[model samples]
Target: MGSLVYREELEEDKNSAFTWEVQANNKAYNRQFKQKAFLCWWRKKYKRNAIHTAKYNVFSFLPLNLYEQFHRMSNLYFLLIIVLQGIPEISTLPWFTLFAPLVCLLTIRATRDLVDDIGRHRSDRAINNRPCQILVGKSFLWRKWKNLCVGDLVCLHKDSIVPADLVLLASTEPSSLCYVETADIDGETNLKFRQAPTITHHELTNIRKMASFQGKVVCEEPNSRMHHFVGCLEWEGKKYPLDSGNILLRGCRIRNTDTCYGMVIYAGFDTKIMKNCGKIHLKRTKLDHLMNRLVVLVSFPKSLLWLRFNPWPGIFLMLQMWPKKSY
Candidate 1:
């Protein structure tokens, strides 16, 4: 059996006329209403996360500030001991009374430091709530629509993250518009020029026309095998025909222009693009966490050791001074 070709299918179905009025009206309405609602939802989420972060920041400072003040006072008390040590006659009277204030200062400082540590823990929780998913290793990925089918071409536009890998059927002149950044796929710092009518077998086999692949990361590794397959992508059970000059910007990909499309070879979690991106990010996050823990472990013991040894001389001198008897 001959493999089904998209252009052949469309040519065979010549009786089906393409209607622009309904699609245009629907797209306009969606762009206005649906997109507005999505933006509002995003704003609300950002505000909520900000509030949580603010609360955490406020609480985190309490311990550090309180203990800092206490530590200052302790230093002052230590200074007083040195001053008292200078006058031999004053040391004869019940000099132990002078040590009381220093002891109190040290105690307060220690307690405040403990409280600050607790506050820091709370702050960390708040920070974690904010989306800090930095794309590491190579790229980041997300599934666009779950219900997409074989030979379906889709359109996507600006500020959209790509849902799947696709071929470039049509795109604006790269020099005329801003350069496209594909750091997630390309793993490079510079933006790449987007030339039209480029073909990659993985995503746009059905889209034979000139188009741009928007919203997906450009794969960086030259040696890695790109997965090419035709399957159903989940989206409200409606199958949109993959056509020429149509834009497909589902999931994280966005189309800058209205008149572009590419065949959907894969969608959802199974897309090779998403899986690779996710794996890169996961490994990066784990490494970051491990480094943080290692830093804490290395520094903490050294700090404790410093505190133990340095403070002893002054404390020893205070203990040795003989108290004068009252006449």
Candidate 2:
């Protein structure tokens, strides 16, 4: 037991020494990147030079917007009739008159969606504009959230939103306890607590003291499960098991501490937030289903009824022949 105690103390001393050295190295690295950030500012005058590339554009953007409208069965049925307007016989004055009103209504709806989509783009800009901490020597420097990358060390301040999925290392709490609010993502208001790796959680919490902290994290690739991370933090020849308990997810707001130090493990779309929200699917209501059925049934018999028989009387007779619902 005495030998084991002696060995533990020796390892702690070695880790502390290494932390200082890492701090020195970090300061040098920060100085080098400072010049590059300024030079690129001239190229991107409005947005940050490091902004994440968007997947949407004017050409593809319009088509995708129209595609959402196309997903509705009602819209499809209405468009099918309008398309037949190409035929001279089908292009009657009454049918053309009805087409105008329908086109106006659809135009109004598309405009509303365009406005809503603009709002989403603005929100995305706000999120990416938020500041993220990048470790520099014994201190942390703030940078745009879009500049954050995997394996970077970041400091989360109280009430600040997390910019990426990171592995907690140390916190203001002596026992390495960190609290975060996840209401934005999970819809829960209560704060949740996260712990740092057991092996090095106690080494240091002060930014200066932990400066030399050089650690290697081995974790599983990004996955859909929010609370199923697996990994280990290796520091100073010792390994600490890492799991969901040690992860601070992006978009979660930090709480109840001056700051907590963490290492970035995932960023951008690879974060759990994006994984959970797979795609935007337009929902179809019961009305849409009915419209689709009506389109199919009417199209096949339109020639027989409209050309030979009286359309109104034939439609009425068919309605009467069908079973009536009793409330």
lDDT of each: 0.38, 0.69
TM-score of each prediction: 0.25, 0.69
In model 2, pairs of residues that clash are: 19-212
Candidate 2 contains a number of clashing pairs equal to: 1
Across 1-327, the per-residue lDDT of candidate 2 in tens digits comes to: 999999996665444332211112233332232223454563311122123334345677667767777776567766777766654544655466658877787788778776776777777788888887787666789888877656567878899888888888888786889999999988999989998876667666567766776666655656567876666666778767778898999789988978788877666766777778676556668887787788768764775667466667657656766788899
- What is every candidate's alpha-carbon RMSD to the true fold? 18.0, 13.8
Tens digit of lDDT per residue, candidate 1, span 1-327?
245586674554443232111111122321231213454463210011111212224455556444444333335444556566656744554556666676676677556655755575666454334231111222222222332322334444454454444433444333222134455554555644433333332333333321322222221211122322222222233433332222232233333443333444333333444344343111135655566566556666776787688777556556666575889
The local lDDT score (0 to 100) that residue 258 gets in candidate 2 is 83
* CA lDDT, candidate 2, residue 114: 69
Candidate 2 lowest-lDDT run of ten: 16-25
